[model samples]
Target: MKSVSYAGLTFETADEIADALLQLAAALGVNERSETVDIPVVEQNGDLSSVQLVIGPASQFISKPVTSPYNEPASAEVVERLTYRTRLLDLPRAAAISDSEIGRLDFDSPA
Candidate 1:
């Protein structure tokens, strides 16, 4: 239960923010070591302290191909067709929280 230190929200509600952070932590697969990191949250449409738990470390993550290696490289047109997910947020679980300042974000969905 770590406290997120950010000044984006107009009003700070520790309980709601904490719950959202915890949910995001599990979805992002954060372990015991990842400290809070800046993440894109759907608030005033800016960055916020979502969580430090990332799918992979920066080095390993940046090296991966857009598509799997076994599969042939995607054509330029095919690559253009790809779009990132933005609405994959879990609503049912998040409903319990009523933090208007924090807003709702599909934290786990690909940016």
Candidate 2:
């Protein structure tokens, strides 16, 4: 079996990105346990919610190049590996959204 993961992010910039990702995963029958979802929130006064959520795989795999006599190939599988991770909310320097908005930080598709 192959191991892969998906991440779902939600921000004020757009309402459909997270929803689309969620749809993609569900349409593909992605194992919920394998996917991680994180949504960091900020406030207007440069304050943040005391609660931060981070969910993902236990660990990630590193890729190695394969050299073959006939051809050189990279890892059989891989995805965009993220490093120096952070949320864009910090840059906006906006204050926290309404409590209602905070609770709405889920990827929900419209029927």
lDDT of 1 at 101: 44
Residue-level error in angstroms, candidate 1, position 75? 44
> Which portions of model 1 miss their true places by more than 4 Å?
1-13, 30-111
**50: Cα error in model 1, Å:** 11
What shift in Å separates residue 5 of candidate 2 from its native position after superposition? Answer: 22
lDDT of 2 by residue, 26-78 (tens): 43232323344332223233343222224333323222222222311121221
Q: Report residue 111 deviation for candidate 2 (angstroms).
A: 36
Q: How many residue pairs clash in each candidate?
A: 0, 6
Task: For candidate 1, write residues 1-111 as lDDT tens digits.
Answer: 122333333211233333444344444443222333333222222223232323212211111112211322223332222111111232334335568745776778899
Question: Against the true structure, whose TM-score is highest?
Answer: 1
Report every candidate's CA lDDT.
Answer: 0.30, 0.30
Worst 10 residues of 2 by lDDT: 75-84
> After superposing candidate 2, which stretches have Cα over 4 Å from the reference?
1-13, 24-33, 42-111
